[model samples]
Target: MLNNRYEILEQLGRGGFGETFLAIDTRMPSRRKCVIKQLKPDDTTNTAPTPGWFEKRFQREAAILEELGQNNRQIPQLYDYFSEGENFFLVQEWIEGITLSQKHQQEGNLSEAQVEKILRELLPVLDYIHGRGIIHRDIKPDNIILRASDGKPVLIDFGIFKEVNNINGGNKTVPLGTPGYMASEQAAGHPVPSSDLYSLGLTAIFLLTGKTPQALTSDPNTGEILWRKDAPHRPSNLAAVIDRAVRFHPRDRFTSAQEMLTGLPGSAGREKTSVVVPPDTKILPPSRFERWFWVIFIVITGGFSFGFGHPIIKPWLDYLFPNEPTVKELPLIEPSSQINSFVLDEDGQTLVGGDEKGNIYLWEVATGKQKKTIAGQGKAILEIAISNDQQILASSSEDGTIKVWDLKTGKERITLPNQRGLIALALSSDGNTLVTGGKDTTVKLWNLSTGNLIETLPVEKEVVSLAINQDASIIVSGHSGGDISFWQKQGSNPYEPRIFPSINPWTAPSVAVSADGTTAASSSCQENIRIWKDSDWKDSPLQAGSSADICLIVISEDGKIIAGRSSDETIRLWNLNTKKEIFSYSPSSPKSFDSPRMIALSGDGRTVASNFDKKIQVWRPSF
Candidate 1:
């Protein structure tokens, strides 16, 4: 619009103090596309202009961007920077690619290889910046783009240039970066180089969870991120590295980007892809702004220590004084000797539950009183599947054994041993066929009455979720690789089993097959409920709804309702056709406690049951 040399195409987004746009720089004959950002100064402040300070800060930031672009291929090149009236504008290369945020939505939560690849690509960029005494105050998924042409990452938006920020004596109050990705020190405006690492770690977490850090729930007191349980594919090695990177205190985090990169698992004895830092390298000493942060830190620390001070404070005073309190007391979830998995029978009269200590409880559904209790096979019950008639209960244990308990007698009828990995159990309606799937990549069928081996199912992948039709004729099995196998009872191979592809296999750890065999509903780490229509699993879904914490899922007999237990101790019911949550049941929990592991829907789909740590409740849906 200014001088007719540039054309505004579309508004990209708005930040705290600026607006971003996509524009074509017609100044060049080729009319190349570029990004234009308008930085507006606060008009409300009446402080006298510090003669040329703003201009000097603007020029310095522009020069820094140019320098970074020249040295690093992953950074966006600066094209032009000019001021129109009180507002400033920056013109830069338009990255023809998707931001990591967009890529995450297009793809699933990043796989481990993707996370490692990201760490490998961007850590060096951080090393380059931190070496020059500049911290990329904003480093979230949105600011990092995956260039389509070369498949490389590009870091953008220096955000309030390091010098321009009023880090001196805490004058700048505007929050920097996106909320979830901002480090504690950055929020306090006393960021060190490590603060960037903290933001990077949070970005990695976002990729893994397909969720912003803000959506994740943290422990009330300790403030530790309770992310592991929700993100299904966190490998311990990578998780440990990320854990240290995002430690609450900057001092407790990796000192430099180089250290964090080198500390990764495969960096040992390898050629350095990332820039290397010198030994004993130290950042420039804290400025006037940092003294304020230190005073704040000391006061907060002293307050807490003295609040519980005296005898407990005296013993640790010497050590705490010498070092920051880096040790975080990650709160422990107090274990209640209670129900771990439960299921409601078709009649809704019998409520059977399996506890962490391998005990079975038969409760009167109407009165909520325990009718019988039997000690199980000395292992935690991972899942419980009830027979259609409410006569038999199948309890899958941590040790790969299925204990079949008689509902009437509360006696162990049979203990079916599986010497493989984790197992999922499902009992058929006629009380005849039993299906057992294991991580060992085997699905076996048994005669429920005698617990004898029937026929082995031909499933080539590690089964994650399993469900059976009422008469044991149709079984739907979801595998670790997002492919589903359907088994139909007949022929020499009998149940003709065929694999059907679905959402990223890692996500569909919870699946439910309608009793009538018309529909199958599945949920994954992506937090969306996918309904696959009768044997034809394709790109288009019947209906997809946003959801989470789907550790256990089940579909109604008519395939009209879908329900699941999420991580937040809630059981939600969804109308399959409308893709709406019909109703939900959530229970308030203590600061630290166990959560439900299993949830189930009855054969008629009229009842739902969930384990409440120490108790199990069966409910009739209001919707």
Candidate 2:
């Protein structure tokens, strides 16, 4: 038994610094099977890092694994990590499936369609990790396992040998990866994001030709692998994409996973089935026949007006019948940069948005026209809050400052500077108090009129989200460690927080509070959405969770409706009273992986606005 709980069943394999084993957890009632990786100092190496350095590296890797596995379903889930004596071990979810290498051995070779399917499904996962600044150094057939439950590929290992870098006065370079699959730059101890793409391209080649990189012939001068002749069934377009991915120089390859995804053959042509009614269609009642009769009458009698070709008759008909007030008929607003954060006006007639390029757009939702554009902070906007009266618009950015703007004048009101970057902001209903939270692990109440700090409440962890009740008597704050705290204002010394135990540690939770302070909801990635009610904060049956993992959530003002975005690139809304989903959709025309998604719902729960890349889409949801 390892770590006094896991019973070793069989040895899986061994790498340079670690060994893996299939084990069973004795602590669980089901005796669940898992994989345990053991890491230790290798005696064969000439130079080794000190024990402190090794321990730090092990801890860092464990944290990364925990974060990646928890947020993504394509990666194996990390259950536990601990140290026993000088050896470190990691327990992970055991995927019951065969590796691509084993699949090739049994099935001969994969067809072109099969290879394309893998590329399409796995590239988004790569984009996700790369967005967080992580590069998988090893991408090979053996490292990808097709899960038995579903055929999706689950990436494993994560390059355990990459941790052995130049540390503790060691001068020799240690290049770590499989000889036949690693990129040329990776082999020289310097790997870029494109290095992983290079290996993935070669993996595709191996799946097609049933030959590893070593067996393929290469150009002597250009150093490009020549394998098109071996895979005669492949199309020229796919071949071209693969060739570019495996280019000789890193600069010549695709810079990011999103670019490579777009380079695929049919990526642009793919789209989700939309339920939105077309703009030309009219959703009218029994007066339709009367309208059609008037139309026929005007065309016949207004021939003199129509013959002039001035559209005089059409203007008269338009005055009789106005355009339908529906989201489908509204003009689409396409901004220059991705919208990072946005909030809808309480009246549901206007939308305020902040973009990645630090610009604030005030859009008229009725006509979808850009009314004003204010130059915002220098960095990407983290959060945007509209006061209850819609007079003050406050936005937080990575530049460590908050800017308050006057909606009527389209001018700046005040600038609140912070010591660190602010992540969350909330405004009181009366527009007098503003609450802000940031990486500094403190929540501050600021007087909006004077731009002065009223009070600061220090917490044990950095706050990730903040919300205030209508009366400003209750404050809901979500911390980076997954703990949601509720603070009540009693007197001058009413800053102490009533803490709830951490939900999923280190995964920031999206939280919202009702305007009346009667309801609150929060959700962490890959976890169930929890609802709390009453002053005691007891659980309510109106909870909702999904297998897709809800990442962003917003509660309606009355607390009767909630909407959120999930990891599967879909938006969903639910009615808290009935506990049923009202509507769901994939909002983008051609979905792309952009950073910092923003969503807003009208107080009446009739309108929803969301950011889809460079576009802002508004919808009057109807089932």
Name the regions of candidate 2 deviating beyond 4 angstroms. Answer: 1-330, 491-493, 544-548, 587-590
What are the per-model C-alpha RMSD values against the true structure? 27.2, 25.7
Error of 1 at 320 (Å): 16
TM-score of each model, in listed order: 0.44, 0.47
lDDT score of residue 154 within candidate 2: 88
lDDT of each: 0.67, 0.72
Q: List the candidate 1 regions with Cα displacement exceeding 4 Å.
A: 46-49, 162-174, 219-222, 270-623
lDDT of 1: 0.67
RMSD of 2: 25.7
Question: Compared with the true structure, what per-residue lDDT tens digits does model 1 show for residues 136-222?
Answer: 889999889999999899999886453343322211223366545766545544455787898898888889987676556555445
Worst 10 residues of 1 by lDDT: 325-334
Query: What TM-score should be assigned to candidate 2?
Result: 0.47
Backbone clash pairs for candidate 2 read: none
Worst 10 residues of 2 by lDDT: 164-173
